[model samples]
Target: MEWNISGQDFVTFSRFVGAALAMGLAAIGSAMGIGLAATGALKSMVRQPERQGEFVRTMFISQAVAESTAIYGLVVAMLLLFTTGGGHTDGIHGSDWVNGLRFLAAGLTMGLGAIGAGYGIGIAGTHAIEAITQRPEMSGVFMRTMFLGMAITESPAIYALVISMILIFVMGAPDAVGVFSGNIMDIARYVGAGLAMGAGAIGAAIGIGTAAAKALVAIARQPAKQGPLVRTMFLSMAITESPAIYALVVSSILIFVFTPTDAEAARIFGGMDLVAIGKYMGGAIAIGFGTIGAGIGLGIAGGGALDGISRNPRKESSLVRTMFLSMAITESPAIYALVISLILLFVFAVPDTMSWAQGWAELAKLLGGGIAIGLGTIGAGAGVGIAGLGGLIGISRRPQKEGAMLRTMFIGMGVTESPTIYALVVSLILLFVASSDVSTMSQGLHDFARFLGAGFAMGAGAIGPGLGIGLATRDALTSMAKQPAHEGALVRTMFLGMAVTESTAIYALVVSLILLFAVG
Candidate 1:
């Protein structure tokens, strides 16, 4: 049998997919979290029969908070399914494809936003149970801490809901015009905006989960020190959550603030408007992927530090200070990525009169900048996590060498960050540098070269540092394990090795910049 599909039909199909994804994924996550919390609460109740009412109440409250994300998703999905109607006509600027794309993005925004929240709520809820079971008297303090962490974790989901709302009610509205009108580029912008918050939220969830889990463990271990530990965790979580906020800001700007050129100009550019779409997409990916690593890295570092403090409560002050410093260092790459993304979003411009090749070149630069910074930071984040993990291990083994191990870890992490710096420089050059005078096809080719080169420079540059830092950390841990007394010498040697390993990434960065500006 043969099958036929019209544009209108495809648009309808897109709406269905969007509605399904938004509701399905969100509900799944919420169910999982609620189930997890309910099960934990039951177990806790069994353990503390007298405090059953308190356990049940806490679980219900946490589950309700978790369910809010699903509700946001459902509301968005329902709006997309019922509120919009029909498809684009030939004469209308809006196309069915554009409408479909908008719904697709809306679905992704809500769906992905719920994923992290679910995992986070589960982690937090499980810990809440443990906290209550361990010390029912401190249930009030534990609940407050859990609620705070869950609230922070839900911020990304809220951001996604906001973006979805804008896309459905504002941008995709049938009567909308100007930037909000559903043009190809505008649709791309909406999609990018959705992705920015959705993907960015993943890291925030993990970070919050890590902090929550550690906080629970700490509270159980030292109920008397709950105040200081909870405060520190919340502070760390605030920093960890900053990248998501940055992504949200960027997504909002892309959705509501970015003004595309006039419809006539768009008509003239025709398909070449893809260059504009590419720019927004690149910005989204840059922030999304860039922040994920930072989130996970902060979680690892913070969680490890909390574990250390719990194990060795006397060193609380030192461990907390070092964790803050390590988390800040780990966060630097994401911050750099945010800067690059902003430059791509706000600084780069393509004239309507420019040849298609020039537009393509501009798009290439935007995409290359995004990839360079985004991928570069992933490696940096991993390196920082590894270095922090090693430092934590070393400290746990020999608390006396906490100072030495932290110093060494910082030096190594700084070296690991070199590639991100190089990536940033190349991204800036790509964003700001103009293409040389050349034929249309040649300029396009040159731009493509810059695009690939920037990505290669940053990606390849990052490899050495990531591996070098991991190796340095591994050996440092080994050395510390074998010769705790000689930690000072081991740290010095590890730093030297990491510095040497990092040089290769610098060379790659130099090559990338050369490719970006000096070549073609």
Candidate 2:
């Protein structure tokens, strides 16, 4: 008997082939676009070295726009394969092949559009840089305009992606078949996703490189404002990084969630559905981005605060409060990410259950853990804010007496950080330990218990004493500030206090270790 593909099978195969073509073709166009744009910008900058700032700002925005082409191609291909009924082999229709080809046409449209947008953005960046070199005074204004232009340039790519996704997912797939095509296809999908993330990496490297070069030039010109300029550069670069991270998150979701797996592999992926992976990855990225933002915010806040203190040293308390508020706001994103991570790892990661009772039981444990940690971070955030504010105030009032006040404030902050640490510990236990079926009394448990407790004991135990010494230093500074003539006496008292506090945290570490490793 002769073997021939059914109408449905042919359509499904065609859709897959189209997606591969769309991605491959778009990749070539994007590569050429990027090279052209970058080269033009470099030439412009070289010609007008004095207009470097304007040129760099323009170039950065241009490059961002150029990168959107690859993003477009990616979005189009995903939609074609996953969304469209053209990929459905269960249906019986002679029109399946035509529908599949139509889907392919949609991909082609988007792919070509991406190429044009990429080239346009690149050219825009090149010219903008050249313009800036000639008019250095208008650098800031030019930078703003450049970004606006780049954003507008990206609109077409976004539209193309939206259209392609609709064609594939909404119009094409109406009951896709052949999910059990061995593991080869799944592995290919995973590899493809991994490769896509390289585009994001490339964008990040270019952005960072450009930002760093400009920053060094700025610092060389204005050493006095070097700190603030560096902070600005870092912040801008981080914002640039957001898109790359988004790409990575999308790639990971595709690889980990969609791929077919054996019973063993299923044991890992099946623990949480596709939605859960998105949540976890999203949360992690949020945290990573927030951390970077916080660093920049803190630096800027500190610089401004120091300047304020210099002008009016007596109002130290008020200055500190402002600084604390800024820092707290800066850290909010990180805290949000932490809460989301806890929810995903604990609440979302659960075994499938046919019965309602089992499902509810799993949910209850997960939700309870999530709520507990979420609340803890809120408290931690508030405490740290207050402590930092108090420290800023104290430091501003007596610049010469900063050493002592800073010590005190740091201790207060340490105390504030403790609750958050506790919450983290609880979340980790819930995620890794409680979710697993391993019993506390098992041999595996014996190893885990010791391993965990010993690590915790050594770390947390050390923290307590370090905090105490920090407090002592603050007290000594305050005392010395009040009576400079009696500094010798204060120093003697401070050392004794510090030693006592340091000893306690150390003891806790020892006890924790003994409970973990020695007991086992």
Candidate 3:
């Protein structure tokens, strides 16, 4: 153990690990995307046995586009393997751990970023094939839509790639340049940035693809309305992209703004500024995990609007109005996440004086609040989408009662959002009220547990009821559409069901409050 740094080429070893992660994770999404393309194309060929060649051609094209993200990852892996950009040229030393983690973060960023984009492109291809099968004459329009959707879906992956390349070619830690470089805090920020970009890409890409897929179907159903449909699709996808944008913003802030200068790293060795660590880490987690559900929800709502438009083209204006409303509400959870992230990043500062244990307590508090809002909103966002889509479908069928149907939709979404609201409350308490100045290690640890326990207790608690309430209200809206004469009965019954479904979120809030206020 006391031997010199001659035991292992740690730098090379770390690069190899990074290479493995980049290619290995990228392979999964690309393979699945390719498989999805093949699956859909094959099914379409079977249905229209004579058009196999055309289907195969489009399938290959889609597969090719989907493969690009993996290709990007491959290039990153190769660079890491050969140490192409730059690295410790001297024989690998033990102090290369910071550089090692930086490269690891790079791989993770590219690998995770490719997943949703690849799969989403494949989804677009699948639906594109279906559109071709249904309306062979307008294959060109469908292809265009498919490609456009795929391109937009790839945006998040592109962001990830940029960050990955930056990590490889520009930034470093072992050969410390920034104040924060080569420190624990720098490592946390780098890793958090990776996660923020990578995971944030998932829901947004899928949502955009969902919209594209449905728009293709709508075009096939109503070619005369293609112009309107395409416009709606563009608007929907634009909004859906914001979640990834929020993640990107957080990633950029972490990488570019809050770095440690070389002087700072030299002066302070292992001074655990837990607040700064929490700021980067917690903010990343908030935007990264929080945007996922909202993006999916927005996509679902958008897709439903396309479906409704195709079904009742005569009511396009009304349906589009409803679509806008639905999307706005569905996107709120991501907004909440962005707000929390901004607050964490800009509002909190490392205290001037504190015990080391007190720092840990602060770290836990920030993380808990971030986790609370991040995970809590997922189910609520998706649930609201479910309800919104159901209401849209119902309105398409019964436009005469649009007013009543929309009222129900509003109530449903309002209730669906309660869980997120509850989580927000807990997060605020942690941010503003939770104690982090305890001098004793025991009290500090206690505060840490209390903060995290409340964060998790409420965040995880609100998820199920949010989705459950949304589903129940969806059916209620549909049922009302079917039997408008019995609207009274349906509305009352839906209220009761949703209230019961919401009880679980209430229980979670109670537990969170108890953790925050009653825990020793």
Judging by TM-score against the true structure, name the best candidate.
3
- List where candidate 2 sits over 4 angstroms from the true fold: 1-228, 231-260, 264-398, 415-419, 432-520
Task: Report the error of model 3 at residue 240, Å.
Answer: 0.8
Query: Which of 1 and 2 is the better model by lDDT?
Result: 1
Residue lDDT tens for model 1, 257-364: 875555532353342565676678889988977887787678777777777777677888777777878888888888888988887777766445456666666667
TM-score per candidate, in order? 0.81, 0.36, 0.92
Model 1 segments more than 4 A misplaced? 1-7, 23-71, 89-95, 173-182, 261-267, 389-399, 433-450, 453-457, 460-483, 486-520
Q: Give the Cα lDDT of each candidate.
A: 0.75, 0.46, 0.84
Clashes of each: 0, 15, 8
Candidate 3 lDDT, tens digit per residue, 233-308?
A: 9998998888899999899898898776555466443325676677788888889889888888888899989999
TM-score of 1: 0.81
